[model samples]
Target: MCDQYRKSYRLGRRPGEQGPRPLSRNQDRVEKLATGTATTTTTKTKPTTDSSTANATTTNSSTANPSITILTTNPTTANSRKTNSTTVNPATVKAKDSSTTTKTITDPGRAKTRKPNQTTTNLTTANSATANSATTNSTTTNSVIVKTRDSVTTNTTGTSTRPARITNKSTITITKVPKCKTQKLKITKNTLTVGTWNVRTLWAAGKLDLLRHEMNRYRYDIIGISEVRWTGKREIPRGDFIWSGENSNHIRGVGILLSTKAKKSLMSYNPINSRIIMARFNATPFNVTIIHAYAPTSDSSEDDIETFYNCVEEAIEKVPKKDVIIITGDWNAKVGTDNTGWESVMGRYGYGSRNERGERLLEFAAEHNLFICNTRFQQTSNRKWTWESPDGIHKNMIDLVIVQKRWKTSVTNCRTFQGADISSDHSLVLCNIKLKLKNKPRHNQRYDVSQLKDQTTRQSYQARIEDNLKNIHSTCNLNEHAAQIEKAVKEALQATVTLEKTSKKSWIFDQTLDLTDKKRKAKQIKHLSADSIKEYKNLCNKVKNRHDRTKKSGYKINVKKLKKDYKLATAEKRTVW
Candidate 1:
């Protein structure tokens, strides 16, 4: 027990950063101990007359509490006999070394503070060797704060394991508080459901509502929508749905819908153009930026393709180097099963044969070091295809989800959901990825400084600051004085300005959404019957025409409002000047 305690105390000090501690005589002992070398020293003392002579003492004293035993021998003058016995609490004895250093070990169970070059070891009720306060050095091993507790075990690697036990005996559990309470919590992200679909046009009546139902059914964190056909740029938030889009001609449009979970981590969404949109999320260790695109069809001009790719490249370049990027949308490309030299970006599970569009996409992905997630996972023929012909005779996998090659393993599954009813020719292509949301520090509350524009408010604020400064004038410490000054300024500003709550307004009507759903169901029925095709087409045209007029009316109202606001602002500016 004494040997074990001494070893634990001595080894507590970490090795020097300049490499091993020059392997001195003392360090040799440490190395031997580390290598399981067993060496012991023993000393015997002899008593003569009435004096007790000292035994050979070690230069390094043991850290454990010591029990000193003194033996005295006295010659009996009359009887000529000798008696030997032990006495406790003997006089404090200091062992002398060649360097004139004195070593002292206190009484058992009473540990003392360790010296600069000293260490301490103690035994708990369970007789385990534990360091009282081990000083850290250059060793990679972490220092652990150990406490005596029943049914508690700690490892040196900074991990603790607690097993479940059913016992009738009452027990008290004491856990050691972590050294740093402000340490960030470890964030672990599991499988996330992401999807993309090209819903011919979001301008159709009730398309957003029908889309919401499908989104809720799949419980997707984020889903990209293409061909939205919505004019202008804006962010629309309804219930748990949030989307951002930009379109000028009401032609091909792209947008992304985020669930409540994703919304909580939503940093910002940028509407790049009618065919492209980007949203960033606060997934940490690396942020995740999802870019939604509606690439031009194969028949589009080469210049159009070049422009589209240029936009895509610009978007990718905008993301930070440390963040993970995912570009998922309808690429209108068909990459066949032959991975060949493109094994890094694709897999053998790809459906159909490679085409000109597919080659372009492959080249883009290779340049960006991205992997197509759809081709990474294997599935059935129906599950692999994302687009089908109107007559349902032809099927192709045009829509795809691509992620950074470095995070390819984060994509657990990528396939099409053949069952989603979004009243579109394209199937919903879903990709599952694992990404953790970082817990960022909350924004500090700020008072409105605009209130300072008023003369009365400005005077009141100045008076408050003066009053606060007077109250904190007694503070002498430099840090304290600065803190008081800051506090005073903040309080004075807060007293002048009250916080206001603002929310965005929605322009689309619920009735219009209902009509869009009716129109969608009619289209679905028309596909099933050759006779009802004409009626279905007529109903679609009617719905489209009505929505077109509604959009035009809404635009006119917005233009008039803008003109009025501009006039009022101009008059106010002239009066102020």
Candidate 2:
């Protein structure tokens, strides 16, 4: 027997007296036998190695079983069968209906085959079987067809006992979609406090500490300092101190100090010689550009004073017009209590009498459209004057705070603090302004180095360093070794040292502070009574005497130490020679 007939015998038929039937003949016989039946059955079979023989067997089985209307197997060709029907490839099948349509869809990994009859639609894959509608009785009308990859279900007027069976596994795939997200923002308000002060000198010991104390007392965000008396330009990250001074001598200098908040907002700074230093800050509504200028004193010649103002004007011109410009420091010019012709630049609440230098200041302000903030606010004589002569009898508001006329409203208040004592002739002049600033994060860690002044803490610090260094493994790479050394020292410091708590504490004696306070009160009341005046004079003398004694003592000690160090160095040099 042929292979096609042999497979048919195994499927439940004995190929007894008939050869394998042609696919066309089998389909015709199946239709004739199913003409009177109301039931339809579909059988799915496994594919044989011989594809052509498998298709022939599948067709013969449909005729053998009258109820089976559809037969499915793996994609195969039936050209070997002696049938007049057209050859059907694995991807395409055509029915006998004249209007039947066939479509084959090809995908990268999947195949789709479609077969259509005159009144029914059928869709199939190379490995799946699906039937939309099928009718066993030709008279049956409007049959409900339910198609699935695994089975074929039909709802009609007549019922059948046989159920369609599907033996092949179906594959299913599921896809997922994605979503989008949004962010929220927060709004806030902040304040900017600016000030100016002539510190006289930062060359003395404990001067910077005293300055920090006064700065904290007033809670200043940015402060311009004059007469820093430190040669060369340098930036100290601690408290954000930036200063510019004379190249060869500790004569005149200009500096600026920024608090934690202000330092974070600082964009840039330019040091123009010893008398002028300008800094810019990032702020809302507008940026802030401040020029800290230590103009020539009254004793200076006209040429010197003119040159100072000219330099200040050039600095002012360099600032962008959109920025809020503030020229503050010891201008050493007094634009007295008068606002007649200079009403645009000065107010009527000024201190002392105006001088020739003051006229120059007024002209500069008018030319630059700047408003003198010092004269804009009504303040007491004591609070308005920022400097006091040596005898405590003469006081003037030489230290001035000026701002752009357009942004004068931002300067809510401007005045001086007479109680802030830094052993300087000038008081701290502060200005309050409203501004929004961004909070910058800082990671630098600082320790209280002052603790090392004690012998016990010093020894403990040294021991901790030695232990930490001993624990580090030596490395050949210079960079790695340096990093390890730095880490070890930091760890040692953290173990043996304490964090600095506040910059408010000062080294000056409490007795001196009390005496200074008493002297301030005496000065405030000196004009009220003759006894008060006498007391003020006495207090002033005592304070001056105390300052002189302290200075002489410090100077003598410094000279003695220098002499001793020089002798020791000379003796060591001689011995070495």
Candidate 3:
């Protein structure tokens, strides 16, 4: 069903060199769908004396997509209101005089918005509710006090689940805070597997006739297919072209494909040449975009893939480069090799260099603050052509996706759908990204006012805080201890990383024995709090013991060590001395 929307926002500076005023109010107001008529409206609001008075009201017929709006204003005079109440009730009160009655979570994630005299609400629930507003240098602050409780979930049937809302004071400020971090995104389900695959070309596989079945086999939330070939200027081959990418077959008709689930959240769309596609996605995760592209193959004449390279570069620039972009699809370029082309591109982001299109991809990702999901476990050789010949000679690994860097630490259970390749030339790679959202304790939050209230509580809180600081200080001190222990353990482990036992090939017993005199001066950092140097000395002793054991007479040399020494012998600087 279609819905309507109304929104207002203003930005200006406050007087007296103070901050600006930003007020936001949401009224999901609906005068029953009377037989006569019913319509929605956006109410205006201004800076309230109390931050708690400001609120957002949302209404809907059922638990589906609802129309929503937001309002923001520059600052007016911020009339500070100071009231002394020794005994404060944890109960929250709405700001302003308006009684915008709507369901709000009992948890105080409710915030006094920054938009002045502005209210928004919608009845469309098919999409995620992204209604939000904020202001910097606002005089308002929220202080949460924790009380012990158990069994937080309600077991009632046909009930709505709401997020635990924290209360933050709205102020007359102008600092840009990333809304994704401030607003809580609802999780639609337990997991959404977002994958990227390079399907060589749609028409190549004898088995690829089963493309539809292959696609439907897995429960995928979002998927990006690269190398969708078509004749130039031709009508789009796929009706589901929510966003189209590059055009290549004779070298420039490849494009991208998205699942119905992902297309449901499209907001803004932009095509990056014939090789790159960019689209802003909406909902639970805030504003995220998908960049579908296929980097050039190393085999191509460098100039041949320049257009695709430009397309990718422009896509990175056209889209909000700072936002989380899932760049997936066929990247024919390999990293981990010394070809140097991959190194050239990765240099733009900061520091990464490799030759395997995979390794270079990893480096490019690192430079651009992105992370690749392919672990060494799931990682495989780039050999074995995805697009095979009748004789099955040529093969190379070239499809992948890289995630935003921040997400790398949280993503889990990453794997590839090699089985899906039964129908296509390339395997379908899939990974279930699990976000381990840190639920920090309320009392431990840095901005908690309870820690700064007065001398008494401040003293108590500072005491606890200092203990934490000291624990950190202690942990840092232990780093040296840990490192020293690590060096010693490494000397032991070094025995295992390669072979250590000497060889007993009697035919070559005359192999010259000379002192390596391996000179490595320890740049000892002196610190009283740090651990003693005894541990490092112990490590030196262990290495000495190993050297002694290996050089002893009549010692039967281990076979593995012989192989290792042979490899080391090939190393000009490294030798058996």
lDDT of 1: 0.62
Report the lDDT tens digits of candidate 1 across residue range 490-530.
88987887654335444555665666657656755676778
- Give lDDT: candidate 3, residue 423: 22
TM-score comparison, 1 vs 2, better candidate: 1
Candidate models: Cα lDDT each: 0.62, 0.65, 0.41
Model 2 local distance difference test score: 0.65
TM-score of 1: 0.50
lDDT of 1 at 15: 34
Models, CA RMSD each: 19.8, 27.8, 30.6
- At residue 559, give the lDDT of candidate 1: 99
* Deviation of model 2 at 157, angstroms: 81
Residue 232 CA displacement from its true place in model 3, Å: 5.9
Ranking by TM-score: 1, 2, 3
Residues 353-452, model 3: lDDT tens digits: 2344456455556566665555322333432123333233454445556677676654554556545542245667665654211221232112324334
Please identify model 1 stretches exceeding 4 Å from their true place. Answer: 1-189, 237-247, 439-577
Of 2 and 3, the candidate ahead on TM-score is 2
**Each prediction's TM-score versus the true structure:** 0.50, 0.49, 0.36
RMSD over all Cα atoms, model 1: 19.8
